[model samples]
Target: MSAALPALTAPTGRRVRVLPGVYAPQHDTHLLLRALAREAIRPGADVIDLGTGSGLLAVAAARRGANVTAVDVARRAVLTARLNALIARRRVAVHRGDLAAPVPGRTYDLVISNPPYVPSPHGPPPRRGSARAWDAGPDGRAVVDRICEAAPSLLRAGGVLLMVHSGLCGTEKTLRRLAEHGLSATVSDVAHVPFGPVVLSRMSWLHGRDLLDRRADREELVVVRAEQR
Candidate 1:
């Protein structure tokens, strides 16, 4: 069962509620939307919100006057996103399929994601296992890697790509992967949320980085922005 999620009201007069245990869009929606709304996106630019958990970004983009399409592999997420869009009274295309699969024959001026980026040991499987929702491989870059590889084809010339993951999951590795895929990345913003013990266990990976900081209680979260080369 998915965890219970809270309902949030966007400053744009939109109401959003993310389903529990299924990658709620409430957490990072504000940080991401703030950065995105400040960008030079044309009034009617095409946008894709990959991993559109609750369709937060998709709804945000639509409100910003862009043609937005949200894609996700989980049926529940897709349904939730579409419903959220409907409740917000925005016309967003919601696709139920893996990354980039349902978006074929179309390209976007901007692509964004807040994918599941926590690395996990090969132990007990999740009561709700969703490779597309989380489990970013041993290094926690699987989904990011795949997204980067496919982004160039999906992004238009000069299109921008924005993403949020974790500092523990090898931010540098993500930057390098983006480069390999012809994307250039820079840390536009970062947030610290005490994610508790399980999250702190991965802190060693972030120790030497300039961007990470540990809280007294120990949990943390990061938001990174990348652009297509």
Candidate 2:
């Protein structure tokens, strides 16, 4: 984890096509990208980017010379990611499906995700639209839990997994979950960012659930890095 990163904004050189209903590259993406930049990926390292919204991370890894596959559940996301990769002139295989489900019978040198971790009072993540990119279940652990469960199977003996999510979902639980799988894990980086429109709209519900203080307007986003033992 030691490479220079550009500013915590969208990459300026390459244009990303943000289609409607797809999550656009934002602060959370930048935070995770910065964390990804730290890793010293060898040329052609096998990498899979789960929940690849616009293929930003996958393309970034490809730029670093890793073989990347970008996976997403939303159809729009899959298309947008592919287009973005094409625009960036990066080699990325874009697939449409749930996290890591589209690819089986393969282990990677690295796995990365910027999953849907917003604490939504809604029943589950939307099956379509931009909300699918961020509205996780009540505790926001729905997707996070799945990633933790899949880590062991998805990684090679010495492979790494890097995921970014909100602290509202329980950072300790994430670390514990990864450790339970016999992987060494830690919160590698954190950013206290202001709530976006989605969370801001659900303020009352989140406060009712005691997930946030009445006056709290910002939340901490953390990148959890884990390595196979």
Candidate 3:
């Protein structure tokens, strides 16, 4: 087990700028970073950041001497991540595509993601809006489930995946899915955080779905670590 790392206030300091409609670094981002910090990333290790919004995690991995590639579905997010990587003077390959589609037939030593997991009553996530960062399908597994299925192919033997998502999306389900895919997985870290604006907006819907209690003021965020053996 890895010791807990201190919370980071901002990823890549204050240099990274988030454009409109791009997801900014928040508690979930920081939590994932903390998990990443515990890993031993050798120099020149291949790392990929899925859903790299502002490119914070990609930049951080580059700073650690890893060859980083970042992917995002939104054009603005792709641009934002590229700009942030440039500003950080880090060599990050930023691509605009869905999940790992931009890098086919490629595997990484480390894969990281803080994908959309908020259960939204709004059907699927918006194609062109800020809500794409958090508004997953009604069960909040739209992207999470995809990641679980893609993770096995994304990782090389001995490669590790560090993913963070809201407990609302089903932590055990993530672990089970990863295991079903032949990876040894566990919840590496967890944090209790107050509902963000997106979740707060759908509090009533969440309660109706029994995903949350009426008195619940916070949600559990979990970092799942899975390794391809």
Candidate 4:
């Protein structure tokens, strides 16, 4: 049997206030944090947290003395991140916009995200509602693909990216896409987590797409780390 994963903990250990409709720090969030913890974040290093959700990753980056910027398309998420940063006594430049849109022509030493990767039976991700936090179009590449396409441009030379998503979205495809974009990428970590409500609700569809096993109750989450040479 695989070892049990550690309990999910907040980045600051203090209470993080999340606004309604914002994505809360969960398995994927903590998994990404674990990956981020392994990287060497120098004081004043530039970092960007795309799809920052509740700004947990941004706060962690700021706490490490990095100059951190966070972006999210959801207004509630943007507000939640700003509030959390304030509560953490950390300075995070939070922006409200699509991934990487707000920071034109800007590159960072580290880019991180836990974007929407759950394959949705719905035709596309909903523009409004709580579902936006996890729902992506069928095949689950809507947002992840965009990030892969933009990562190389978003990173400074020798920079790194750490993104976490469910393996159902095609881990190999992500690595290949990054490689095609000239980044050396690999799966740095993996975790088998039981299907959450979102995935459980679409089990039949996932099975139809061969993305899930008929008898399996868990799904794999992978942290893809890619470096810009």
Error of 4 at 143 (Å): 0.5
**CA lDDT of each candidate?**
0.72, 0.87, 0.90, 0.89
lDDT of 1 at 227: 68
Q: Tens digits of per-residue lDDT for model 2 on 48-151?
A: 99999878889999999999999999887898788778877889999998888888878999999999998887798777667778888889998999999999
Rank the models by TM-score, top first. Answer: 4, 3, 2, 1
Candidate 1 lDDT over residue span 1-229, tens digit each: 1346567665455667766545654445666777787778788999998888888889888888899989987777887888788778999999988787886789889998887676655433243545446566556676777877888788877888888776657777777877888877777767766564444565555444422454444434455566655
The per-residue C-alpha lDDT of model 2 at residue 176 equals 99
lDDT at residue 70 of model 1 (Cα atoms): 91
Per-residue CA lDDT of candidate 3, range 124-221, in tens?
87887888999899999999999999999999999999999999989999999999999999999999988888888888889999988787778999
Per-candidate TM-scores read 0.81, 0.93, 0.94, 0.94
In order of listing, the candidates' clash counts read 5, 2, 0, 0
Query: Between which residue pairs do clashes occur in model 4?
Result: none
Tell me the tens digit of each residue's lDDT in model 4 across 1-229: 1123122247546567777678888888878989998999999999999999889999999999999999999998898888878878999999999998998999999999999999988889989888888998998999999999999999999999999999899999999999999999999999988779888887888999998878777889999999998
lDDT at position 117, candidate 3 = 93
lDDT of candidate 4 at residue 91, scale 0 to 100: 97
lDDT for residue 51 in candidate 1, whole number 0-100: 86
